[model samples]
Target: MRLLRDLTNITFLELDVTSTKSIASAYRTVENQTGGKLHYLVNNSGAGFVMPLLDSDIEMGQHLFDVNVWGVVRVTQTFAPLLVRAKGTIVNNISTASCMGLPYQGMYCGSKAATRLMSETLALEMKPLGVAVVIVITGNIRTRYQGGSYFSSIAERIGVYARGEQGHPQMEANLYATKVVGDVLGGAEGTIWRGAQSTIVKFALAMIPTWLMNQLAVKGTGLDVMEI
Candidate 1:
């Protein structure tokens, strides 16, 4: 936020994507500010949890979906009219976890996966109206997200058996952030893989046979100890 404050043209608004009232207020503010046309909307609000399925509560899972999946939906739905008016672009930031079931990140993975599919459908829906939707399939980025997910602080403990082969290259998101804006400005749409080795990781997961992938998953996450 301090970074955004440094910019003269940036208008900062506190928006809670999970709250309809907050979204509505933000919509009214942006609509009035932009004269009822918004060109770019990025659904990037995210929440993370680091726990095994056994340790996860239903409420915890619901909260994850609320922030990660439903948050995007709510934001998009509210801002879509403005987007259509401007024939704008919508960028939805997702994660590599969308495609894989990572150890100790059950609901996080599930929420991202849901976001991925929802973004795809949104793209199709927006295209006819000249509103582009881009789904950013991001990998690991070193930032508050790590802190948010407790990936380093908490997941490190619960994930002890889950870190077999390693995942993500642990990156600075600025590299992809700027690239994505450039790509969107250049008319890129659909899915753009970003973050360190994001494409390679997704490809590897896709190409690996199910059995071998299972072996890797189990051995990597140390779940192989339960092999019968």
Candidate 2:
């Protein structure tokens, strides 16, 4: 609203990325407003979840993929026609987690990884149509998203396993891994250095051997004990 106060050409449309009907409506609005010419379309809607793969039910897993992966597909498909008409570009906001899998957040990582691959394929497939696809792989940044959704529930479960003093080695490993990742992310609300630190980590992860990267992920995210 504040930005609209100073800008007259900008328009905002209420969009639900997960719903095709909603996406179609948004596309129509944009088409009508801009006369079917779109210079750039960015897919940035995503969801985050924090829980062990074992604890996450199918529904929960599906929800994560729906929003993070399928939503992008829906939006892109809906707007591709307009983009083709304008010979525009599509930018996808991906994550570094997509590059390397992380424990506890496996579902979220997997969804993002799938989206990255999809975007890559789209880049090649749409090139002939003069539609350029660009993907921005972001590392950890300061945001309040860590506290929303299932964060508290997942944290509580992990906490129970931590304080119970039970002889469960897996839970113990999970507790340790969770703490390590939490520290790396600078806990819930990240610090100013988070963006830079995460970018460095991504660079490091990319330069290392795949096996070494997996080993680090296993130790850091407690995926060593997780059964595939």
Candidate 3:
């Protein structure tokens, strides 16, 4: 937040991801401010919620898709002209959840999976235009965007228990928090600008078959059938 405030020429536009008009207006504002020239577009806005696939509310799922999938598309499409002109780079802030499926976070993972495919396709498409496209697959970060108090309220309302286990829910939440903190400390700067090794690992895992990937995910997360 302070970064935005500190930047002199940077303009912050508040727009709803679900609305095309909002997206268009934001673009117009940028163009007006910068005289139709732009550089370095970073798509970092997204939303997610932690809930089981079955019990996940339809509205929450839709909200996640709106912000995570359509939002990136909207922003990218709107700002692409500027990027093309500048021959600049587009950095999409993706997530590790795009590859590894976690328990009770199905909605978030599904949205990110969509984003991953979109990013991949866009990278190929934009290659011809001399505009570089980079998808930053991040692990986690200590941010309030993870629905802080809202998650607790939702858990309380839903009566948190997955197949007669109470501690599992608490453990899942704690693990998520711990990982987020670790990632922040480990230098995730809203993008994967460093640590190229992790990026290679993610790409390798993504190339694996679905069945094998699922097995690896389950095993890696320690979420065997007996545990879940």
Candidate 4:
């Protein structure tokens, strides 16, 4: 991640996505640091929780929504005026799971789905004011947040164990993360290209009929369509 940062123009800022005050303060700091002119704002911060829906803790669901859905709403609302002032763009980094609907990651996916809709609605509302709202539906990306050990710990605690060829979700997540990290470290251009592809796919999917989209999502995630 550091290497990628060093190779790109991206700047990292520390902020608690779940906290409105923290987000506001961070925005203020960034504005002051950059002299109050923000051209492009990307709401990419998120966290995930994976567990069977019945066994999942309600508090965990709240936390996931806090960071994944409400956080984007809060950050975008805070920075929207600035973006509108600059006629800038706001990109919300959503997930393929938002539409695909994976098992165990229901909370995370639900939050992302909510955010995706919010972004679309905001895009329409902001268009009249010349503010561009873009939702980037991203696929799996390698990062510390996708660490295998972290997911394994959660799986173990939640009693969602898998044996033999049953398919360990944690292992799959780890592999996906590793591939994403490799892509990021390989070059900024490739990562951007992959992101573009994801956004295009998301846009195309959004244009499909709801029932068809639901069917495709069931096929994509290997989940029973009736279950969702």
Q: How far off is residue 212 in model 3, in Å?
A: 8.6
Please report the candidate that would top lDDT against the real structure. Answer: 1
lDDT of the structure predicted as candidate 4 = 0.65
Predicted structure 3, TM vs. truth: 0.68
Runs in model 1 lying further than 4 Å from the true structure: 147-168, 226-228
What is candidate 4's lDDT per residue for 112-136, written digit by digit as tens? 8898888878888988887766665
**Ranking of all predicted structures according to TM-score, beginning with the best and ending with the worst:** 1, 2, 3, 4
Ranking of models by lDDT: 1, 2, 3, 4
Local error of candidate 2 at residue 218 (angstroms): 4.6
lDDT of 3 by residue, 51-104 (tens): 657767899899889899988998889889978887767777777777767667
> Runs in model 4 with CA error above 4 Å?
4-12, 147-228
How far does residue 118 in candidate 3 sit from its true spot (Å)?
A: 0.9
TM-score of 2: 0.72
- lDDT (Cα, tens digit) per residue for candidate 2, span 114-220: 99899889988988998877666665443344544334434554444334322322223234334434443332211111232355656677698888877866562
Worst 10 residues of 4 by lDDT: 187-196
Candidate 1 collision pairs: 161-221, 162-221, 164-220
Candidate 2 lDDT (Cα, 0 to 1): 0.69
lDDT of 1 at 177: 79
Candidate 1: residue 127 lDDT (0-100): 93
Q: TM-scores for all candidates?
A: 0.88, 0.72, 0.68, 0.65
In model 2, state the lDDT of residue 104: 68
